[model samples]
Target: MTILICNSIIILITKTDPALQTPMYFFLRNFSFLEICYVTVTIPRMLVDLCTQKGNISFLSCAAQMCFVLMLGGVEFFLLTVMAYDCYVAIGNPLNYTIVMNQQVCVQMVAASWISVIPVVIGQTYQIFSLPFCGSNRINHFFCDIPPVLKLVCGEAFVNKIAVYIAVVFFVIIPFLLIIVSYGKIISNILKLTSARGRAKAFSTCSSHLTVVILFYGTASITYLEPKPNQYEGMGKLLSLFYTILIPTLNPIIYTLRNKDIIVALRKLLAKLLA
Candidate 1:
Protein backbone atom coordinates (compact mmCIF):
# COMPACT_ATOMS: atom_id res chain seq x y z
CA MET A 1 0.00 0.00 0.00
CA THR A 2 2.75 2.45 0.86
CA ILE A 3 4.62 1.65 -2.31
CA LEU A 4 1.51 2.09 -4.40
CA ILE A 5 0.76 5.44 -2.76
CA CYS A 6 4.31 6.72 -3.15
CA ASN A 7 4.42 5.76 -6.81
CA SER A 8 1.00 7.31 -7.28
CA ILE A 9 2.34 10.49 -5.77
CA ILE A 10 5.17 10.41 -8.30
CA ILE A 11 2.62 10.06 -11.08
CA LEU A 12 0.55 12.84 -9.60
CA ILE A 13 3.53 15.13 -9.15
CA THR A 14 4.75 14.60 -12.69
CA LYS A 15 1.35 14.92 -14.31
CA THR A 16 0.31 18.01 -12.41
CA ASP A 17 3.59 19.92 -12.63
CA PRO A 18 4.31 21.83 -15.80
CA ALA A 19 8.04 21.75 -15.07
CA LEU A 20 7.96 17.97 -15.38
CA GLN A 21 6.62 18.03 -18.94
CA THR A 22 9.84 16.98 -20.65
CA PRO A 23 10.40 13.63 -22.28
CA MET A 24 12.35 12.39 -19.29
CA TYR A 25 9.68 13.15 -16.71
CA PHE A 26 7.04 12.01 -19.17
CA PHE A 27 8.72 8.63 -19.17
CA LEU A 28 9.17 8.83 -15.39
CA ARG A 29 5.43 9.32 -14.96
CA ASN A 30 4.77 6.25 -17.03
CA PHE A 31 7.40 4.37 -15.08
CA SER A 32 5.73 5.31 -11.82
CA PHE A 33 2.45 4.03 -13.15
CA LEU A 34 4.15 0.79 -14.10
CA GLU A 35 5.60 0.54 -10.60
CA ILE A 36 2.11 0.82 -9.17
CA CYS A 37 0.79 -1.92 -11.40
CA TYR A 38 3.86 -4.05 -10.77
CA VAL A 39 3.49 -4.22 -7.00
CA THR A 40 -0.27 -4.52 -7.11
CA VAL A 41 0.07 -7.69 -9.16
CA THR A 42 1.91 -9.61 -6.45
CA ILE A 43 1.95 -7.87 -3.08
CA PRO A 44 -1.76 -7.85 -2.38
CA ARG A 45 -2.02 -11.56 -2.93
CA MET A 46 1.01 -12.18 -0.80
CA LEU A 47 -0.46 -10.10 2.00
CA VAL A 48 -3.73 -11.97 1.76
CA ASP A 49 -2.01 -15.31 1.92
CA LEU A 50 0.06 -14.19 4.84
CA CYS A 51 -2.96 -12.99 6.77
CA THR A 52 -5.12 -16.00 6.02
CA GLN A 53 -2.34 -18.57 6.02
CA LYS A 54 -3.79 -19.90 2.80
CA GLY A 55 -1.50 -19.83 -0.19
CA ASN A 56 -3.99 -21.49 -2.48
CA ILE A 57 -4.58 -19.84 -5.83
CA SER A 58 -6.86 -21.03 -8.58
CA PHE A 59 -5.27 -21.98 -11.88
CA LEU A 60 -7.07 -19.23 -13.75
CA SER A 61 -6.16 -16.61 -11.15
CA CYS A 62 -2.56 -17.74 -11.17
CA ALA A 63 -2.51 -17.52 -14.94
CA ALA A 64 -3.93 -14.01 -14.84
CA GLN A 65 -1.36 -12.93 -12.25
CA MET A 66 1.47 -14.34 -14.30
CA CYS A 67 0.18 -12.64 -17.44
CA PHE A 68 0.00 -9.24 -15.77
CA VAL A 69 3.40 -9.73 -14.16
CA LEU A 70 5.07 -10.59 -17.46
CA MET A 71 3.39 -7.72 -19.28
CA LEU A 72 4.26 -5.09 -16.66
CA GLY A 73 7.80 -6.40 -16.23
CA GLY A 74 8.41 -6.40 -19.99
CA VAL A 75 6.96 -2.93 -20.42
CA GLU A 76 9.12 -1.65 -17.56
CA PHE A 77 12.33 -2.72 -19.30
CA PHE A 78 11.20 -1.13 -22.55
CA LEU A 79 10.34 2.10 -20.73
CA LEU A 80 13.74 2.12 -19.06
CA THR A 81 15.36 1.70 -22.46
CA VAL A 82 13.30 4.62 -23.76
CA MET A 83 14.36 6.68 -20.76
CA ALA A 84 18.01 5.92 -21.41
CA TYR A 85 17.56 7.06 -24.98
CA ASP A 86 15.85 10.15 -23.75
CA CYS A 87 18.81 10.87 -21.49
CA TYR A 88 21.16 10.21 -24.36
CA VAL A 89 19.38 12.76 -26.51
CA ALA A 90 19.27 15.35 -23.74
CA ILE A 91 22.94 15.05 -22.89
CA GLY A 92 24.42 13.90 -26.19
CA ASN A 93 22.52 16.27 -28.46
CA PRO A 94 21.15 19.09 -26.42
CA LEU A 95 20.40 21.31 -29.39
CA ASN A 96 17.94 18.96 -31.07
CA TYR A 97 16.69 17.19 -27.97
CA THR A 98 13.38 19.02 -27.90
CA ILE A 99 12.73 18.57 -31.59
CA VAL A 100 13.74 14.92 -31.66
CA MET A 101 11.84 13.91 -28.52
CA ASN A 102 8.75 15.92 -29.20
CA GLN A 103 5.34 14.97 -27.80
CA GLN A 104 4.48 12.64 -30.65
CA VAL A 105 7.75 10.74 -30.41
CA CYS A 106 7.43 10.24 -26.65
CA VAL A 107 3.86 8.97 -26.98
CA GLN A 108 4.81 6.61 -29.76
CA MET A 109 7.70 5.18 -27.77
CA VAL A 110 5.53 4.59 -24.70
CA ALA A 111 2.83 3.04 -26.82
CA ALA A 112 5.35 0.77 -28.42
CA SER A 113 6.61 -0.26 -25.00
CA TRP A 114 3.13 -1.19 -23.83
CA ILE A 115 1.99 -2.82 -27.07
CA SER A 116 5.10 -4.81 -27.88
CA VAL A 117 4.87 -6.94 -24.74
CA ILE A 118 1.38 -8.27 -25.35
CA PRO A 119 2.31 -11.05 -27.70
CA VAL A 120 5.22 -12.24 -25.60
CA VAL A 121 3.19 -12.29 -22.40
CA ILE A 122 0.27 -14.01 -24.06
CA GLY A 123 2.42 -16.59 -25.77
CA GLN A 124 4.47 -17.35 -22.65
CA THR A 125 1.41 -17.65 -20.46
CA TYR A 126 -0.37 -19.91 -22.89
CA GLN A 127 2.63 -22.09 -23.47
CA ILE A 128 3.22 -22.56 -19.75
CA PHE A 129 -0.39 -23.23 -18.78
CA SER A 130 -1.11 -25.46 -21.75
CA LEU A 131 1.35 -28.03 -20.43
CA PRO A 132 0.19 -31.01 -18.37
CA PHE A 133 0.28 -30.81 -14.55
CA CYS A 134 -0.08 -34.17 -12.85
CA GLY A 135 0.31 -34.88 -9.11
CA SER A 136 1.57 -32.41 -6.51
CA ASN A 137 0.21 -29.14 -7.88
CA ARG A 138 2.41 -27.13 -5.56
CA ILE A 139 4.30 -24.10 -6.86
CA ASN A 140 7.56 -23.79 -4.94
CA HIS A 141 7.67 -20.03 -5.18
CA PHE A 142 5.29 -17.39 -3.94
CA PHE A 143 3.70 -16.56 -7.29
CA CYS A 144 3.26 -18.25 -10.63
CA ASP A 145 6.62 -17.27 -12.04
CA ILE A 146 7.94 -19.06 -15.09
CA PRO A 147 10.49 -21.36 -13.47
CA PRO A 148 8.61 -22.63 -10.44
CA VAL A 149 5.44 -23.14 -12.39
CA LEU A 150 7.42 -24.86 -15.11
CA LYS A 151 8.71 -27.24 -12.44
CA LEU A 152 5.16 -28.32 -11.69
CA VAL A 153 4.52 -29.34 -15.27
CA CYS A 154 4.23 -33.15 -15.41
CA GLY A 155 6.58 -34.20 -18.17
CA GLU A 156 9.46 -32.67 -20.04
CA ALA A 157 9.38 -28.88 -19.87
CA PHE A 158 12.55 -28.50 -21.87
CA VAL A 159 10.69 -26.95 -24.78
CA ASN A 160 8.75 -24.67 -22.45
CA LYS A 161 11.93 -23.74 -20.62
CA ILE A 162 13.56 -22.93 -23.93
CA ALA A 163 10.63 -20.73 -24.88
CA VAL A 164 10.95 -18.94 -21.54
CA TYR A 165 14.66 -18.31 -22.10
CA ILE A 166 13.91 -16.90 -25.53
CA ALA A 167 11.28 -14.60 -24.08
CA VAL A 168 13.69 -13.48 -21.36
CA VAL A 169 16.26 -12.67 -24.02
CA PHE A 170 13.72 -10.60 -25.91
CA PHE A 171 12.07 -8.89 -22.96
CA VAL A 172 14.97 -8.49 -20.53
CA ILE A 173 18.37 -8.86 -22.10
CA ILE A 174 17.62 -6.98 -25.31
CA PRO A 175 16.23 -3.89 -23.57
CA PHE A 176 19.08 -3.93 -21.07
CA LEU A 177 21.55 -4.00 -23.94
CA LEU A 178 19.85 -1.03 -25.53
CA ILE A 179 20.06 0.86 -22.25
CA ILE A 180 23.73 0.04 -22.06
CA VAL A 181 24.35 1.34 -25.55
CA SER A 182 22.45 4.52 -24.83
CA TYR A 183 24.41 5.10 -21.64
CA GLY A 184 27.65 4.39 -23.47
CA LYS A 185 26.90 7.13 -25.92
CA ILE A 186 25.75 9.38 -23.14
CA ILE A 187 28.98 8.87 -21.22
CA SER A 188 31.07 9.58 -24.31
CA ASN A 189 29.15 12.75 -24.90
CA ILE A 190 29.44 13.83 -21.29
CA LEU A 191 33.21 13.41 -21.33
CA LYS A 192 33.47 15.71 -24.31
CA LEU A 193 32.11 18.64 -22.27
CA THR A 194 34.87 21.17 -21.38
CA SER A 195 33.51 22.25 -18.00
CA ALA A 196 33.47 20.05 -14.89
CA ARG A 197 30.10 21.57 -13.91
CA GLY A 198 28.68 20.58 -17.26
CA ARG A 199 29.81 16.99 -16.79
CA ALA A 200 28.43 16.88 -13.24
CA LYS A 201 25.08 18.29 -14.31
CA ALA A 202 24.79 15.87 -17.19
CA PHE A 203 25.62 12.86 -15.02
CA SER A 204 23.26 14.04 -12.31
CA THR A 205 20.38 14.02 -14.75
CA CYS A 206 20.89 10.34 -15.40
CA SER A 207 22.12 9.07 -12.04
CA SER A 208 18.67 8.32 -10.65
CA HIS A 209 17.70 6.50 -13.80
CA LEU A 210 20.94 4.57 -13.80
CA THR A 211 20.44 3.58 -10.18
CA VAL A 212 16.94 2.30 -10.95
CA VAL A 213 18.16 0.36 -13.97
CA ILE A 214 20.83 -1.33 -11.91
CA LEU A 215 18.50 -2.20 -9.05
CA PHE A 216 15.82 -3.55 -11.37
CA TYR A 217 18.00 -5.46 -13.82
CA GLY A 218 20.36 -6.74 -11.19
CA THR A 219 17.67 -8.26 -9.01
CA ALA A 220 15.65 -9.46 -11.98
CA SER A 221 18.62 -11.20 -13.57
CA ILE A 222 19.54 -12.91 -10.35
CA THR A 223 15.99 -14.08 -9.80
CA TYR A 224 15.15 -15.25 -13.32
CA LEU A 225 18.43 -15.99 -15.03
CA GLU A 226 20.42 -17.87 -12.39
CA PRO A 227 20.38 -21.61 -11.90
CA LYS A 228 17.94 -22.53 -9.12
CA PRO A 229 18.99 -25.58 -7.14
CA ASN A 230 16.51 -27.46 -4.93
CA GLN A 231 18.45 -26.42 -1.83
CA TYR A 232 18.13 -22.76 -2.87
CA GLU A 233 14.34 -22.65 -2.98
CA GLY A 234 14.15 -20.26 -0.02
CA MET A 235 16.77 -18.06 -1.61
CA GLY A 236 14.72 -17.95 -4.78
CA LYS A 237 11.66 -16.67 -2.92
CA LEU A 238 13.78 -14.01 -1.22
CA LEU A 239 15.05 -12.82 -4.61
CA SER A 240 11.51 -12.75 -5.97
CA LEU A 241 10.41 -10.66 -2.99
CA PHE A 242 13.23 -8.24 -3.61
CA TYR A 243 12.39 -7.56 -7.25
CA THR A 244 8.62 -7.62 -6.93
CA ILE A 245 8.32 -5.67 -3.69
CA LEU A 246 11.56 -3.96 -2.78
CA ILE A 247 12.28 -2.48 -6.19
CA PRO A 248 8.90 -0.80 -6.45
CA THR A 249 9.29 0.53 -2.92
CA LEU A 250 12.71 1.94 -3.69
CA ASN A 251 11.90 3.55 -7.06
CA PRO A 252 10.01 6.55 -5.71
CA ILE A 253 12.75 7.23 -3.21
CA ILE A 254 15.44 6.97 -5.87
CA TYR A 255 13.63 9.31 -8.25
CA THR A 256 12.19 11.77 -5.76
CA LEU A 257 15.00 12.01 -3.24
CA ARG A 258 17.70 12.17 -5.87
CA ASN A 259 15.88 14.57 -8.16
CA LYS A 260 15.88 18.32 -7.61
CA ASP A 261 13.01 18.91 -9.96
CA ILE A 262 10.76 16.43 -8.18
CA ILE A 263 11.64 17.92 -4.79
CA VAL A 264 10.88 21.41 -5.99
CA ALA A 265 7.65 20.38 -7.62
CA LEU A 266 6.58 18.57 -4.48
CA ARG A 267 7.24 21.64 -2.39
CA LYS A 268 5.33 23.86 -4.79
CA LEU A 269 2.37 21.50 -4.76
CA LEU A 270 2.42 21.33 -1.00
CA ALA A 271 2.58 25.12 -0.75
CA LYS A 272 -0.43 25.55 -2.98
CA LEU A 273 -2.44 23.06 -0.98
CA LEU A 274 -1.46 24.70 2.29
CA ALA A 275 -2.32 28.13 0.91
Candidate 2:
Protein backbone atom coordinates (compact mmCIF):
# COMPACT_ATOMS: atom_id res chain seq x y z
CA MET A 1 0.00 0.00 0.00
CA THR A 2 2.79 2.40 0.83
CA ILE A 3 4.59 1.46 -2.34
CA LEU A 4 1.42 2.04 -4.28
CA ILE A 5 0.84 5.46 -2.79
CA CYS A 6 4.41 6.68 -3.00
CA ASN A 7 5.07 5.45 -6.50
CA SER A 8 1.73 6.78 -7.65
CA ILE A 9 2.65 10.18 -6.31
CA ILE A 10 5.92 9.98 -8.18
CA ILE A 11 4.18 9.13 -11.44
CA LEU A 12 1.51 11.76 -10.95
CA ILE A 13 3.96 14.49 -10.11
CA THR A 14 6.35 13.56 -12.82
CA LYS A 15 3.60 13.59 -15.42
CA THR A 16 1.68 16.64 -14.29
CA ASP A 17 4.66 18.91 -13.77
CA PRO A 18 6.18 20.40 -16.90
CA ALA A 19 9.58 20.87 -15.32
CA LEU A 20 9.95 17.16 -14.59
CA GLN A 21 9.98 16.01 -18.22
CA THR A 22 13.70 15.58 -18.75
CA PRO A 23 15.15 12.26 -19.76
CA MET A 24 16.02 11.31 -16.21
CA TYR A 25 12.56 12.08 -14.87
CA PHE A 26 11.02 10.56 -17.95
CA PHE A 27 12.78 7.31 -17.06
CA LEU A 28 11.81 7.81 -13.45
CA ARG A 29 8.14 8.22 -14.34
CA ASN A 30 8.23 5.00 -16.29
CA PHE A 31 10.03 3.25 -13.45
CA SER A 32 7.46 4.48 -10.93
CA PHE A 33 4.69 3.07 -13.09
CA LEU A 34 6.63 -0.14 -13.47
CA GLU A 35 7.01 -0.45 -9.74
CA ILE A 36 3.26 -0.18 -9.37
CA CYS A 37 2.77 -3.00 -11.85
CA TYR A 38 5.69 -5.02 -10.49
CA VAL A 39 4.53 -5.01 -6.88
CA THR A 40 0.90 -5.48 -7.89
CA VAL A 41 1.91 -8.64 -9.74
CA THR A 42 2.29 -10.37 -6.36
CA ILE A 43 1.26 -8.28 -3.36
CA PRO A 44 -2.52 -8.52 -3.60
CA ARG A 45 -2.44 -12.26 -3.99
CA MET A 46 -0.03 -12.37 -1.10
CA LEU A 47 -2.50 -10.38 0.97
CA VAL A 48 -5.31 -12.77 0.09
CA ASP A 49 -3.17 -15.74 1.00
CA LEU A 50 -2.18 -14.17 4.28
CA CYS A 51 -5.81 -13.65 5.20
CA THR A 52 -7.31 -16.96 4.03
CA GLN A 53 -4.26 -19.26 4.01
CA LYS A 54 -5.16 -20.51 0.54
CA GLY A 55 -2.33 -20.14 -1.97
CA ASN A 56 -3.11 -22.74 -4.55
CA ILE A 57 -3.38 -21.51 -8.12
CA SER A 58 -4.42 -23.35 -11.26
CA PHE A 59 -1.81 -24.31 -13.83
CA LEU A 60 -3.00 -21.72 -16.31
CA SER A 61 -3.15 -19.04 -13.63
CA CYS A 62 0.30 -19.95 -12.40
CA ALA A 63 1.67 -19.85 -15.93
CA ALA A 64 0.08 -16.49 -16.56
CA GLN A 65 1.41 -15.01 -13.35
CA MET A 66 4.89 -16.31 -13.94
CA CYS A 67 4.93 -15.07 -17.54
CA PHE A 68 3.71 -11.61 -16.65
CA VAL A 69 6.10 -11.31 -13.71
CA LEU A 70 9.07 -12.38 -15.77
CA MET A 71 8.17 -10.02 -18.59
CA LEU A 72 7.79 -7.09 -16.23
CA GLY A 73 11.01 -7.97 -14.44
CA GLY A 74 12.85 -8.07 -17.73
CA VAL A 75 11.46 -4.69 -18.73
CA GLU A 76 12.56 -3.26 -15.38
CA PHE A 77 16.05 -4.63 -15.79
CA PHE A 78 16.27 -3.01 -19.21
CA LEU A 79 14.87 0.25 -17.90
CA LEU A 80 17.43 0.35 -15.12
CA THR A 81 20.22 -0.16 -17.61
CA VAL A 82 18.80 2.59 -19.80
CA MET A 83 18.62 4.84 -16.76
CA ALA A 84 22.23 4.12 -15.92
CA TYR A 85 23.17 5.04 -19.45
CA ASP A 86 21.11 8.20 -19.15
CA CYS A 87 23.13 9.16 -16.08
CA TYR A 88 26.31 8.40 -17.93
CA VAL A 89 25.35 10.62 -20.81
CA ALA A 90 24.17 13.46 -18.59
CA ILE A 91 27.40 13.46 -16.63
CA GLY A 92 30.00 12.41 -19.18
CA ASN A 93 28.70 14.45 -22.08
CA PRO A 94 26.79 17.31 -20.54
CA LEU A 95 27.28 19.50 -23.61
CA ASN A 96 25.66 16.97 -25.92
CA TYR A 97 23.30 15.55 -23.32
CA THR A 98 20.23 17.32 -24.61
CA ILE A 99 20.78 16.31 -28.20
CA VAL A 100 21.81 12.75 -27.38
CA MET A 101 18.90 12.18 -24.99
CA ASN A 102 16.31 13.96 -27.05
CA GLN A 103 12.63 13.13 -26.56
CA GLN A 104 12.48 10.75 -29.50
CA VAL A 105 15.43 8.73 -28.24
CA CYS A 106 14.00 8.63 -24.73
CA VAL A 107 10.74 7.21 -26.01
CA GLN A 108 12.61 4.70 -28.12
CA MET A 109 14.68 3.55 -25.17
CA VAL A 110 11.57 3.03 -23.04
CA ALA A 111 9.68 1.31 -25.84
CA ALA A 112 12.65 -0.90 -26.53
CA SER A 113 12.83 -1.89 -22.90
CA TRP A 114 9.21 -3.01 -22.93
CA ILE A 115 9.24 -4.53 -26.39
CA SER A 116 12.52 -6.44 -26.33
CA VAL A 117 11.45 -8.67 -23.42
CA ILE A 118 8.32 -10.18 -24.96
CA PRO A 119 9.96 -12.96 -26.97
CA VAL A 120 12.58 -13.75 -24.37
CA VAL A 121 10.10 -13.94 -21.52
CA ILE A 122 7.60 -15.95 -23.56
CA GLY A 123 10.19 -18.52 -24.54
CA GLN A 124 11.58 -18.79 -21.03
CA THR A 125 8.15 -19.02 -19.41
CA TYR A 126 7.09 -21.68 -21.90
CA GLN A 127 10.12 -23.81 -21.13
CA ILE A 128 9.60 -23.43 -17.41
CA PHE A 129 5.92 -24.37 -17.35
CA SER A 130 6.37 -27.03 -20.03
CA LEU A 131 7.96 -29.35 -17.49
CA PRO A 132 5.58 -31.79 -15.84
CA PHE A 133 4.48 -30.83 -12.39
CA CYS A 134 4.11 -34.38 -11.11
CA GLY A 135 5.63 -33.55 -7.77
CA SER A 136 4.17 -31.33 -5.03
CA ASN A 137 2.27 -28.39 -6.51
CA ARG A 138 2.99 -26.28 -3.49
CA ILE A 139 5.46 -23.52 -4.36
CA ASN A 140 8.06 -23.00 -1.66
CA HIS A 141 8.00 -19.28 -2.23
CA PHE A 142 5.19 -16.79 -1.71
CA PHE A 143 5.09 -15.88 -5.41
CA CYS A 144 5.32 -17.70 -8.71
CA ASP A 145 9.03 -17.21 -9.29
CA ILE A 146 10.86 -19.44 -11.75
CA PRO A 147 13.31 -21.06 -9.35
CA PRO A 148 10.79 -22.27 -6.77
CA VAL A 149 8.33 -23.34 -9.44
CA LEU A 150 11.05 -25.34 -11.18
CA LYS A 151 11.61 -27.29 -7.98
CA LEU A 152 8.06 -28.66 -8.21
CA VAL A 153 8.52 -30.11 -11.67
CA CYS A 154 9.25 -33.75 -12.37
CA GLY A 155 12.33 -35.22 -14.15
CA GLU A 156 15.76 -33.75 -14.66
CA ALA A 157 15.35 -30.08 -15.56
CA PHE A 158 18.29 -29.70 -17.88
CA VAL A 159 16.45 -27.44 -20.34
CA ASN A 160 14.90 -25.43 -17.55
CA LYS A 161 18.28 -25.10 -15.83
CA ILE A 162 19.75 -23.73 -19.02
CA ALA A 163 16.85 -21.33 -19.33
CA VAL A 164 17.43 -20.15 -15.78
CA TYR A 165 21.07 -19.50 -16.49
CA ILE A 166 20.17 -17.64 -19.66
CA ALA A 167 17.66 -15.53 -17.77
CA VAL A 168 20.31 -14.73 -15.15
CA VAL A 169 22.68 -13.65 -17.86
CA PHE A 170 20.17 -11.67 -19.91
CA PHE A 171 18.09 -10.02 -17.21
CA VAL A 172 20.50 -9.76 -14.29
CA ILE A 173 24.15 -9.95 -15.21
CA ILE A 174 24.05 -8.11 -18.51
CA PRO A 175 22.19 -5.11 -17.15
CA PHE A 176 24.38 -5.11 -14.05
CA LEU A 177 27.48 -5.08 -16.21
CA LEU A 178 26.11 -2.20 -18.27
CA ILE A 179 25.36 -0.26 -15.13
CA ILE A 180 28.90 -0.86 -13.89
CA VAL A 181 30.34 0.29 -17.20
CA SER A 182 28.13 3.38 -17.26
CA TYR A 183 29.18 4.32 -13.77
CA GLY A 184 32.79 3.56 -14.56
CA LYS A 185 32.66 6.17 -17.30
CA ILE A 186 30.74 8.51 -15.02
CA ILE A 187 33.44 8.22 -12.34
CA SER A 188 36.17 8.87 -14.86
CA ASN A 189 34.40 12.06 -16.01
CA ILE A 190 33.78 13.15 -12.42
CA LEU A 191 37.49 12.78 -11.61
CA LYS A 192 38.39 15.00 -14.53
CA LEU A 193 36.51 17.95 -13.04
CA THR A 194 38.94 20.47 -11.52
CA SER A 195 36.60 22.19 -9.05
CA ALA A 196 35.61 20.37 -5.89
CA ARG A 197 32.17 21.95 -6.05
CA GLY A 198 31.78 20.94 -9.70
CA ARG A 199 32.81 17.40 -8.81
CA ALA A 200 30.31 17.33 -5.95
CA LYS A 201 27.55 18.58 -8.24
CA ALA A 202 28.33 15.92 -10.79
CA PHE A 203 28.44 13.23 -8.15
CA SER A 204 25.15 14.35 -6.60
CA THR A 205 23.23 13.63 -9.79
CA CYS A 206 24.32 10.01 -9.64
CA SER A 207 24.42 9.32 -5.91
CA SER A 208 20.73 8.44 -5.52
CA HIS A 209 20.72 6.26 -8.61
CA LEU A 210 23.91 4.54 -7.48
CA THR A 211 22.32 3.83 -4.11
CA VAL A 212 19.24 2.40 -5.81
CA VAL A 213 21.39 0.34 -8.17
CA ILE A 214 23.37 -1.11 -5.28
CA LEU A 215 20.28 -1.97 -3.29
CA PHE A 216 18.45 -3.42 -6.32
CA TYR A 217 21.43 -5.29 -7.75
CA GLY A 218 22.55 -6.45 -4.34
CA THR A 219 19.27 -8.21 -3.53
CA ALA A 220 18.95 -9.48 -7.10
CA SER A 221 22.49 -10.83 -7.01
CA ILE A 222 21.66 -12.79 -3.89
CA THR A 223 18.45 -14.09 -5.45
CA TYR A 224 19.51 -14.84 -9.06
CA LEU A 225 23.30 -14.66 -9.32
CA GLU A 226 23.94 -17.70 -7.19
CA PRO A 227 27.22 -19.42 -7.94
CA LYS A 228 25.63 -22.88 -7.76
CA PRO A 229 22.50 -24.18 -9.40
CA ASN A 230 20.91 -25.12 -6.07
CA GLN A 231 21.95 -21.98 -4.24
CA TYR A 232 18.35 -20.84 -3.76
CA GLU A 233 17.81 -23.94 -1.62
CA GLY A 234 17.02 -22.54 1.80
CA MET A 235 16.48 -18.79 1.63
CA GLY A 236 14.88 -18.05 -1.75
CA LYS A 237 11.53 -16.97 -0.41
CA LEU A 238 13.05 -14.59 2.11
CA LEU A 239 15.18 -12.96 -0.57
CA SER A 240 12.24 -12.65 -2.97
CA LEU A 241 10.16 -11.04 -0.25
CA PHE A 242 12.96 -8.58 0.38
CA TYR A 243 13.23 -7.56 -3.26
CA THR A 244 9.55 -7.67 -4.22
CA ILE A 245 8.16 -6.01 -1.13
CA LEU A 246 10.83 -4.29 0.90
CA ILE A 247 12.75 -2.83 -2.01
CA PRO A 248 9.71 -1.31 -3.72
CA THR A 249 8.65 0.20 -0.44
CA LEU A 250 12.07 1.71 0.06
CA ASN A 251 12.51 3.01 -3.49
CA PRO A 252 10.12 5.93 -3.16
CA ILE A 253 11.64 6.92 0.14
CA ILE A 254 15.09 6.70 -1.31
CA TYR A 255 14.32 8.95 -4.28
CA THR A 256 12.17 11.49 -2.49
CA LEU A 257 14.65 11.83 0.34
CA ARG A 258 17.79 12.05 -1.71
CA ASN A 259 16.65 13.80 -4.86
CA LYS A 260 16.05 17.53 -4.63
CA ASP A 261 14.17 17.75 -7.94
CA ILE A 262 11.69 15.09 -6.86
CA ILE A 263 11.33 16.80 -3.50
CA VAL A 264 10.63 20.10 -5.23
CA ALA A 265 8.13 18.44 -7.51
CA LEU A 266 6.43 16.80 -4.56
CA ARG A 267 6.19 20.07 -2.70
CA LYS A 268 4.77 21.85 -5.72
CA LEU A 269 2.28 19.03 -6.23
CA LEU A 270 1.19 19.19 -2.60
CA ALA A 271 0.86 22.95 -2.61
CA LYS A 272 -1.22 22.82 -5.77
CA LEU A 273 -3.44 20.22 -4.18
CA LEU A 274 -3.79 22.20 -0.99
CA ALA A 275 -4.62 25.33 -2.95
Cα-based TM-score, every candidate: 0.97, 0.96
Model 2: per-residue Cα lDDT over 217-269, one tens digit each: 78877776566646656676777887789988998898889888889989998
lDDT of 1: 0.90
lDDT: which candidate is best? 1
- CA deviation > 4 Å runs, candidate 2: 227-234
Provide the overall lDDT of each model, using Cα atoms, as 2-decimal numbers.
0.90, 0.86
lDDT of 1 by residue, 116-153 (tens): 99988998899889999998988888888987887788
